[model samples]
Target: MDDLEKAETVLQALKTAEQQPPQAALPILNGLAGLVQGDPDAPLEVQEVRADVFMAICELGKALHRGQPAEALWAPALTAAKRWRGLLG
Candidate 1:
Protein backbone atom coordinates (compact mmCIF):
# COMPACT_ATOMS: atom_id res chain seq x y z
CA MET A 1 0.00 0.00 0.00
CA ASP A 2 2.78 2.35 0.99
CA ASP A 3 6.27 2.70 -0.41
CA LEU A 4 7.89 0.39 2.11
CA GLU A 5 5.19 -2.21 1.58
CA LYS A 6 5.64 -1.98 -2.17
CA ALA A 7 9.40 -2.30 -1.80
CA GLU A 8 9.02 -5.36 0.39
CA THR A 9 6.67 -6.95 -2.11
CA VAL A 10 9.16 -6.26 -4.84
CA LEU A 11 11.89 -7.79 -2.75
CA GLN A 12 9.88 -10.95 -2.21
CA ALA A 13 9.03 -11.20 -5.86
CA LEU A 14 12.65 -10.72 -6.81
CA LYS A 15 13.76 -13.36 -4.35
CA THR A 16 11.25 -15.86 -5.66
CA ALA A 17 12.07 -15.17 -9.26
CA GLU A 18 15.76 -15.65 -8.64
CA GLN A 19 15.50 -19.43 -8.92
CA GLN A 20 12.62 -19.61 -11.37
CA PRO A 21 12.49 -19.13 -15.10
CA PRO A 22 13.31 -15.62 -16.26
CA GLN A 23 9.86 -15.52 -17.76
CA ALA A 24 8.56 -15.86 -14.22
CA ALA A 25 10.50 -12.73 -13.39
CA LEU A 26 8.79 -10.58 -16.01
CA PRO A 27 5.50 -10.07 -14.20
CA ILE A 28 7.32 -9.38 -10.97
CA LEU A 29 9.54 -6.77 -12.63
CA ASN A 30 6.53 -5.16 -14.30
CA GLY A 31 4.68 -5.11 -10.99
CA LEU A 32 7.65 -3.51 -9.26
CA ALA A 33 7.97 -0.88 -11.98
CA GLY A 34 4.31 0.00 -11.55
CA LEU A 35 4.72 0.07 -7.79
CA VAL A 36 7.63 2.45 -8.09
CA GLN A 37 5.62 4.71 -10.39
CA GLY A 38 4.85 8.16 -8.91
CA ASP A 39 7.25 7.41 -6.11
CA PRO A 40 9.25 10.54 -6.60
CA ASP A 41 10.70 10.15 -3.11
CA ALA A 42 11.98 6.65 -3.66
CA PRO A 43 15.69 6.24 -3.09
CA LEU A 44 18.00 6.55 -6.05
CA GLU A 45 19.21 2.99 -5.49
CA VAL A 46 15.67 1.72 -5.76
CA GLN A 47 15.16 3.51 -9.02
CA GLU A 48 18.43 2.19 -10.39
CA VAL A 49 17.66 -1.38 -9.44
CA ARG A 50 14.16 -1.14 -10.88
CA ALA A 51 15.69 -0.03 -14.12
CA ASP A 52 18.17 -2.88 -13.94
CA VAL A 53 15.36 -5.35 -13.46
CA PHE A 54 13.46 -3.93 -16.40
CA MET A 55 16.49 -4.17 -18.63
CA ALA A 56 17.37 -7.66 -17.43
CA ILE A 57 13.83 -8.85 -18.12
CA CYS A 58 13.93 -7.53 -21.64
CA GLU A 59 17.26 -9.15 -22.35
CA LEU A 60 16.16 -12.41 -20.83
CA GLY A 61 13.01 -12.43 -22.97
CA LYS A 62 14.96 -11.62 -26.09
CA ALA A 63 17.40 -14.43 -25.46
CA LEU A 64 14.62 -16.90 -24.77
CA HIS A 65 12.54 -15.87 -27.75
CA ARG A 66 15.53 -16.14 -29.99
CA GLY A 67 15.74 -19.86 -29.12
CA GLN A 68 18.68 -19.49 -26.84
CA PRO A 69 18.95 -21.72 -23.81
CA ALA A 70 17.07 -20.56 -20.72
CA GLU A 71 20.12 -21.38 -18.63
CA ALA A 72 21.99 -18.64 -20.41
CA LEU A 73 19.77 -16.03 -18.84
CA TRP A 74 19.30 -17.58 -15.42
CA ALA A 75 22.53 -16.48 -13.83
CA PRO A 76 22.30 -12.89 -14.94
CA ALA A 77 18.63 -12.66 -14.08
CA LEU A 78 19.28 -14.09 -10.64
CA THR A 79 22.19 -11.75 -10.13
CA ALA A 80 20.16 -8.72 -11.12
CA ALA A 81 17.23 -9.81 -8.96
CA LYS A 82 19.55 -10.24 -6.03
CA ARG A 83 21.00 -6.83 -6.61
CA TRP A 84 17.53 -5.33 -6.74
CA ARG A 85 16.59 -7.03 -3.48
CA GLY A 86 19.74 -5.83 -1.77
CA LEU A 87 19.24 -2.30 -2.99
CA LEU A 88 15.79 -2.19 -1.43
CA GLY A 89 17.16 -3.06 1.97
Candidate 2:
Protein backbone atom coordinates (compact mmCIF):
# COMPACT_ATOMS: atom_id res chain seq x y z
CA MET A 1 0.00 0.00 0.00
CA ASP A 2 0.94 3.63 -0.39
CA ASP A 3 2.34 5.60 2.53
CA LEU A 4 -0.92 7.36 3.30
CA GLU A 5 -2.75 4.06 3.31
CA LYS A 6 -0.07 2.62 5.53
CA ALA A 7 -0.49 5.49 7.96
CA GLU A 8 -4.23 5.08 8.07
CA THR A 9 -3.75 1.41 8.76
CA VAL A 10 -1.38 2.18 11.59
CA LEU A 11 -3.78 4.72 13.05
CA GLN A 12 -6.60 2.22 12.91
CA ALA A 13 -4.44 -0.33 14.63
CA LEU A 14 -3.58 2.15 17.33
CA LYS A 15 -7.24 2.93 17.86
CA THR A 16 -8.10 -0.73 18.11
CA ALA A 17 -5.33 -1.27 20.59
CA GLU A 18 -6.74 1.05 23.25
CA GLN A 19 -7.16 -0.41 26.77
CA GLN A 20 -4.65 -3.10 25.88
CA PRO A 21 -1.16 -3.50 27.25
CA PRO A 22 1.44 -0.96 26.21
CA GLN A 23 3.80 -3.63 24.97
CA ALA A 24 1.21 -4.63 22.42
CA ALA A 25 1.38 -1.19 20.87
CA LEU A 26 5.09 -0.76 20.53
CA PRO A 27 5.51 -2.49 17.18
CA ILE A 28 2.62 -0.53 15.71
CA LEU A 29 4.21 2.66 16.92
CA ASN A 30 7.42 1.57 15.30
CA GLY A 31 5.58 1.07 12.04
CA LEU A 32 4.19 4.58 12.25
CA ALA A 33 7.65 5.95 12.99
CA GLY A 34 9.10 4.11 10.03
CA LEU A 35 6.55 5.72 7.73
CA VAL A 36 7.47 9.15 8.98
CA GLN A 37 11.19 8.55 8.77
CA GLY A 38 11.32 6.44 5.64
CA ASP A 39 10.28 9.07 3.12
CA PRO A 40 12.92 11.45 1.91
CA ASP A 41 11.33 12.32 -1.44
CA ALA A 42 8.09 13.72 -0.03
CA PRO A 43 7.17 17.32 -0.86
CA LEU A 44 7.36 20.02 1.78
CA GLU A 45 3.72 19.77 2.77
CA VAL A 46 3.89 15.99 3.16
CA GLN A 47 7.13 16.31 5.07
CA GLU A 48 5.53 18.78 7.45
CA VAL A 49 2.72 16.31 8.04
CA ARG A 50 5.19 13.53 8.62
CA ALA A 51 6.94 15.63 11.20
CA ASP A 52 3.73 16.44 13.04
CA VAL A 53 2.53 12.88 13.00
CA PHE A 54 5.97 11.72 14.03
CA MET A 55 5.89 13.96 17.06
CA ALA A 56 2.44 12.79 17.99
CA ILE A 57 3.48 9.18 17.70
CA CYS A 58 6.60 9.79 19.73
CA GLU A 59 4.63 11.38 22.52
CA LEU A 60 2.01 8.67 22.46
CA GLY A 61 4.62 5.96 22.44
CA LYS A 62 6.46 7.44 25.38
CA ALA A 63 3.29 7.79 27.40
CA LEU A 64 2.31 4.21 26.61
CA HIS A 65 5.76 2.95 27.48
CA ARG A 66 5.56 4.72 30.80
CA GLY A 67 2.36 2.83 31.65
CA GLN A 68 0.04 5.74 31.15
CA PRO A 69 -3.60 4.94 30.60
CA ALA A 70 -4.67 4.47 27.01
CA GLU A 71 -7.16 7.32 27.23
CA ALA A 72 -4.21 9.64 27.48
CA LEU A 73 -3.06 8.64 24.03
CA TRP A 74 -6.12 9.26 21.87
CA ALA A 75 -6.73 12.97 21.52
CA PRO A 76 -3.36 14.19 20.29
CA ALA A 77 -2.86 11.31 17.90
CA LEU A 78 -6.39 11.74 16.58
CA THR A 79 -5.76 15.42 16.05
CA ALA A 80 -2.58 14.73 14.15
CA ALA A 81 -4.31 12.08 12.03
CA LYS A 82 -7.14 14.48 11.24
CA ARG A 83 -4.65 17.12 10.16
CA TRP A 84 -2.91 14.64 7.95
CA ARG A 85 -6.22 13.71 6.35
CA GLY A 86 -7.03 17.37 5.77
CA LEU A 87 -3.86 17.75 3.77
CA LEU A 88 -5.27 15.46 1.10
CA GLY A 89 -8.33 17.53 0.35
By lDDT, who's the top model here?
Answer: 2
Candidate 2 local lDDT, 1-89, one digit each (tens): 67667567656766765545678876677677665563678677877876887888888788788877657667778677666656643
Judged by TM-score, which candidate is best?
2
Give the per-residue lDDT digits (tens) of candidate 1, residues 1-89.
86556556655665665566656655555565575453557678777766765666567656655656655665665566567656655
Give candidate 2 misplaced runs (Cα > 4 Å): none
Candidate 1, run of 10 with poorest lDDT: 29-38
Model 1 regions more than 4 Å off: 1-38
RMSD of 1: 3.7
